[model samples]
Target chain A: MSDNISSSRLTDIDGWGRSESLRSIARRSFQFFYDNYFRVEWEGLEKIPDDGGALLVSNHAGAIPMDAPIIMHGVEQHLGRPVYGLADHFFRQIPVVGTMWSRLGGVPAHPDNAYRLLRDEHQLALVFPEGTKGTSKVFTQRYRLRRFGRGGFVEIAMKAGVPVIPIAVVGSEETMPILFKINSLAKATGLPYFPITANWLMFGPILGTAISLPAKFKLRVLDPVHFNVPPDQDRYSKSRIMDESESIRLTIQENLYDMLAHRGNPWLG
Target chain B: MGRRVLLTGLGTFWGGKVAQSLEKHPDVDVIVGMDVTEPIVELERTEYVRADETYSILSRIVDATQVDTIVHTFLVVDSTQMKTKRLHEINVIGTMNLLAAAGCAGTPVRRVVVKSSGMVYGCTGRDPLWFLEETPRTDPPETTIEDSLVSAEGYLRDFAQDNPHVSVTLLRFSNVLGNDISTPFTETLSRGIAPSIFGFDPQLQFIDEDDVVSAIEFATSANVPGIYNVAGDGLIPWSEVAKICGASNLPLPPFGTEAAASILRKMGLVKFPPEILQLLRFGRGIDNSRFKDLGFSYKYSSLGAVERFAKTKRLSKAIGIPRSPYTYDKDVESFFHHSPSVVRSTQSDSTSDTF
Candidate 1:
């Protein structure tokens, strides 16, 4: 209870390596993109429970994947609840972006990290099971979902005893459409995939990789996928897990087509 | 009869500190401490005996003394203290020999408490936020020290399975920060600049040095079996740790960090070993709840330990540590411990609680 107990701490970083002060600073920048640039719209946001933990599974695209920030910012703004965006551990391999990402609630997409966040801490966790494969799609293959990584995310939700909430986002594909990818370059660099985005062609070397186009975003939250089976099992049925995983994928794919069909313009709602 | 204890690594920080505290315990009847060198700390009742670093004649000593408890506190966790071969000899071979001596056909040792480091859970990108007692390492051991500890723990696991009658307590202590003990971290913080992986601020867990002694004592005295993680509560970022120590973060290039750290080490500017280097990139944390469930408590949290270390460093800066406050004299110590003519008094230490 002494003043020196926690007074010596220079930053407000938590055990998860997330810092509220830093998150707020990052939020200010993200708020601009969420409001003006993307103009993201959401439907059935209340389906994301007011309390308890739930896993958010969404479609992933864009050279930079702007859907993560758009969804996280919208949830945080409306519900005032922090949403932990789980991505590939590759993000942690980078230097400054790694630390900045962690401070801004970007957790490495480890199943253990996800379970701890959802079951133990009871916080909303967002995951794009498509991983890099989803983001690797070119402009021609836009809106087409990829295989959710062996249904590992479903297994984690089953183990953590949380509902899997499928989220369908339209317009993320156009944010920074991948014109094509250079596999040899990706192999040379040790990255999963190297994409040449349309943004890069327009904005040149620097701003190309950083900027996302003005794409009107529409996100729909589907009904929660509850396994209803008990939690914390050592192993769940693999067949059942894949079935649930593929079902969720189909639902999101269906929702994307519906949302896109309703929108008259790609840049206007 | 009261408990007879044999403590290894008497000259080391943990061995000496624990021996000092154990000497005051009413239940402890015999204290036989063995090490490669003379104990730096003065002791009232601990009988010192010189042994090889690998403790070659450990079985003979255990058989002759018939000590009921063996406290293995000498395993080296610090990589910079010595060469790799020496580290392997002390950590793996020394532990294997000690366990062999304690668990031989008809040994008197009933309880064995081994002081392990949290480094056994190697830090990696795939590691969980909080590792439970049963959580397996995300990656295999990358450094010699980590490999040696993992191997020693493997032997310990086998020992526990073979000897059900004997209690085995493995206390995996987090990176320690306190007065006196010199680890790679302590050395870094004592210097003016604490080099960090550029753009990487890993969350690190710490245990106070005094709490390290207490945790070992708790495991030694209690019948708590199985492995337990002993760390101060919570984790703090490396940046915050440097700030607490009043040291600036000298960012080492994250891309070529190992090369940069080696260059710094060559210049004698820092001592960031491969293990510490990986730790700087990705920190490790272990859940300490299982140990707390055993009714043990830590006096300081991670923040408290850092704050205390900073204060102690400041004081030591103002006035350097007293040079050789106590030196071991073999003749006098032998006489006081063995000479029947010298009148002895009951060691009802009034200040035992302070330690």
Candidate 2:
């Protein structure tokens, strides 16, 4: 309702890879939790470019991945434009969830899709460099950043010539804190890792960890960092891309620690 | 002396139209229309030759008419309209006949124009976004129809190589859509409920019937050598076309759609051959720059051709009522306004370019 574009102008939000109808339906269903349950607090949205493409690099957590949708909702609500989330290739390999994820503008994390979203379509893209490693981190390692994958995100941003906005999302780690991870059985179920959570084993799976804990969410959007790399440069050059990736990672890690220090308890934001 | 043209497949609707157009041309001194069956419509300045497109008969006709220009329009776009075996004979064996006759000593056929379809570049997941004229024909004959066309083109290439006097021009067209043309594509669009592959919407290219006629006429009038991909400007996703046609999209899983299509075929609900299912799932696209380089311009863009088809369907009271006089969804319009495939091909010269 706060959007400058009229309802008539918003007819069928379907783009190349984004289906507006399904995205809105999923957003509405998730908004109930984003607003009432987690009570998400969004900040620094004006940093996102009003037009043209940009990348939002966020930290991934929560075994169930409520953070991605929450971030997407926050960006959509504040920016009044859609955000395409890049997911792991494994996410699209899953059955019903894969279709739902794609319909909600979750593109496979292939370099081609990333390049097209950012450079070609000129749409906001949300990426988690930490990937599955960040999601499967145990409770003891909460808020600890993992090695961002080979700096592929940096290379994509470099090739696209778009600014990267660092986002640190709090409370995603406590939603369904994993105590143990079982990798042997994960292969059978097509899951990356089978996390044994206190809420799932002790409390019923349906009423427990499956339902994310009501920990308040703080989504902090940092300043945008612009990069200028020649489009034809070899993307595999580690010295340039890795350094950029490490810097972005350090920024998110510092922001995470800052937000954690200010908060009184892990249970309350 | 003015040009004397011999047009094959005059019995077919397209051939008849080409003959009628050439009949009115003052430069064409003689127009000989050849086909085994009688044409449905008769033209004033054209002479009909009742002979099959075999080597012996075609060579005799060539000797008798002494025609300098040959326009071959016999490629059967839809094989279901005729018997499958006869369709094979007409499309494959008939092409071999034309090639042999054109290469015969003192044939006088200096210019050859053959009408082909874009299906030669098979629609597969591995296909490049836009198939250039030089893209190797990688569609290994999956069906009898594909085999026929592939062999026909091969024979044409051989004939052109063996006989240097004849300049062969092959115009590989995308799916032709017009109210008068009853192709499998048009049949699907005309239905109230069109079945599509679930969760997959591939980009489709089209040429209007009028543009096709003009292209053939232009090719016959001029001597443009070598093969060219003849497609109209712009590309539209299949879903957008379905929306513009006001057909309720019935998305069917690939595995289930085959079984359903077979059953529907029995009930007369579906007319497309089973091989066409692959094209429905992954559509074919072609680059039309080679066609434009030949000094011919297309009046109707792919979007315009579709709108014109929809309008004709509306006026003829054939298809369901559209939501409005067909305008594309704004989002789709903006998405393809600057086509990523076209722009990327021009903007970047790297292998990592994404289309």
Interface CA root-mean-square deviation for model 1: 1.6
| Runs off by more than 4 Å, candidate 2 | A1-32, A41-44, A55-64, A86-103, A106-121, A127-210, A215-267, B1-175, B189-191, B197-207, B214-255, B274-311, B314-355
Expressed as tens digits, the lDDT of each residue in B1-355 for candidate 1 is 7789999999998899999888778788899999998998888788999999888899999999999999999989999999999999999999999998899989998999999999998888888877887889978898999999999999999999999999999989999998789899998889867888888889899989999999988888889989999999999998888888899888888787888889889999987798988889988888899999999988998888999998878878888877558788999999988899877666565226533
Give the Å error, residue A204, model 1. Answer: 2.2
Which candidate leads the pack in DockQ? 1
lDDT of 2: 0.77
Residues A171-258 of candidate 1 have per-residue lDDT tens digits of 8999999998999999999989999999999999699988889989999999999998899999999999999999999999999989
DockQ of each: 0.67, 0.05
How much does each candidate deviate at the interface, measured as C-alpha RMSD after superposition? 1.6, 7.1
Per-candidate TM-score against the hidden true structure: 0.96, 0.66
Tell me the deviation in Å of residue B211 in model 1: 0.9
